[model samples]
Target: MKQCWLDIRAAEGLKSVLCQEAIHRGFDAIVADDPADLAGLPPTVSRVLLPGKELPDAFGDADLVIVDPVQHGEPGRLAARHPGVRFGAHVDVTDADSLAVACASVTRDPVTVLRFADPTNIPLEIVLAAAADAHGLIVTTVERAADAPVFLGVLEHGPDGVMLAPSAPGEAGRLKDAVERRSPDLELTELTVTAITHAGMGERACVDTCTYLARDEGILVGSRAKALVLCVSETHPLPYMPTRPFRVNAGAIMSYTLADGEHTRYLSELRAGGTVLAVGADGRSRPVVVGRVKIETRPLLSIDAVAEGGEAVNVIVQDDWHVRILGPGGAVLNSTALQPGDRILGYLPRRERHVGYPIDELCYEQ
Candidate 1:
């Protein structure tokens, strides 16, 4: 199982139901309910009150990002910016389909999410190789908004350390004094932040994907940011991430990208007899670009064709790193770094064969 950054959203009761579902399904939980607390949070399962502004600069790694439209106080425009994070705004209490669609929409972007999961429900620290989630902790003395100066006061207790000042006046002075007081034995650096949220020392509803050892195998969905695949060496009767948290290239293969050499979403067990395909699949019929490859750019575009609903009539195979069809498949393909301006075009697919345009003859923008 993977360690998940579960963002509990109240967009129509996702928060009300998310925690209970995770618990009933037996997951570690981290509850951050207030919006103010989320100001400088690192990725963790938190209930947020979205004011429609973007998440703070201090927000850290997160696979799942949920938003409740009510929290935003208007149309949920916040969903557009974080294309990589799964999305859902509260429509009503019975809107499971809408929630699922929102999750799918955001996770379809091209990026591999790191993961860790545990089958037995254990501590989050068990699977950390290094700092997988947090880069640094944002600590404060004041537990409430009124406590901002308290954070400054507490800092004074620490061992003498480097000082940083914000452009703001009162905040700068108080924080400096706090550090001088509680200074510990270790080095402490002072940074100014209006607020911060953290990974509470409690149940984390989800984990980084590798946190669990599973015996079974099934489709791993990157449909949600926090989605993960747990390998206990035995398959469980249910789905890997039942929440439908992320999106995959297809309904079958969940996807991920390489980060610092560890596998995520889908684990690379290195078992024998598996062929790693290098084809970069696309949704177009025109040749795709491989900016990191032999050429600088190439066109491999495809159109979504459906007899009825939204489904592609054909698929595109591009030679570019960003064939524009990025999704779950770092598992199937390997990446080769390209010098600037190098690119390639492998193949392209089309919705309907134009009377004059064969998949081979069609040309698209690079």
Candidate 2:
């Protein structure tokens, strides 16, 4: 599970507020320099102490310990000195080389707390790179509530957690909401294309999500409950017009969408207030709200596919140049150029669902 910690060393008065919010949002732990500041905090939250070189007597009671590499020789040596201690490295982001060394050194540790000494000048790309390098729990410190989502939403699976400082009071709840809403990476399966046929003119649904989708992002849509194909969004640049970076010209109104986990919803059922999973070619998904749904009469094409288990499915899509499905090796197969034998990437659900929830009863969709 991902962990989010709250730092209350600087703004002690906001400890109660931050701790309460952390407990409410199911945050992992709270970090403080003084043990007295941890008073009255809920037992559910792990109490972390950022102690100096000399471990205090109360250090034994801490759920986790964060040691600065500058003050304490090296993280590995410290771990060896204090055997069985849950130690994490606290590195300052301003020192790029030191930060890289700390991130590399703490890959084997259980956690690493990255402190942004200059929050105003912190580079997000550097932080993301550090996260990619670190193998353990990556806990970042945020100066404000808005900074939380920026780190949590960057990559498909962002940081393992964020550390909220008391510099921003009464903002923990908002930060928690942002982190909880960020979706994790998803899995994409490969399906063999069986046939491609013209379905004539029909009304297709074009879904526009609220998030700014990249060129590789799209949604999963299909005809059957078991096998679903990835419907690329309108982010690809065309020769005629500017790209719509927020829209996924998905498929027919009746096409099934793998929006809900272990369940599916019809494209026509999506609304402006509903949420859908925008998946990238790498199979990482993030939840995006539906801002609008456009249905228009256009020439349609039906695509038939078979899964590894011999289960067959199909999806009807608009016969346009922008409408595309992800092919094997992450290739983008435009709807207008699809052939009968093209292999495409899809999702094969392992179980049946009812009312958008997984169930044991057998279900079928044409």
Model 2 spans > 4 angstroms off: 1-184, 260-263
**Model 2 lDDT tens row, 236-314:** 7788889898998899998888665545788999999898888888888867799999999999999898877788878
Error of 2 at 6 (Å): 8.6
Worst 10 contiguous positions by lDDT, candidate 2: 119-128
Residue 19 lDDT (model 1): 43
Candidate 1 lDDT, tens digit per residue, 1-366? 212222333323344344444334333222243544344443333333322345444323333333444444222355466454443332222244433432332233221111112222111122121123432211111222233332222323211111221223233334334333321121111111111122122210111222122222112212122221110111222244332211112211212211111122222221123211122222111111111111112333221212122221222222323212222221222112222222211211221122212234443322
Among the numbered candidates, top lDDT falls to 2
Best by TM-score: 2
Whole-model lDDT, model 1: 0.25
**Candidate 1 residue runs with Cα over 4 Å from true position:** 4-33, 39-65, 69-366
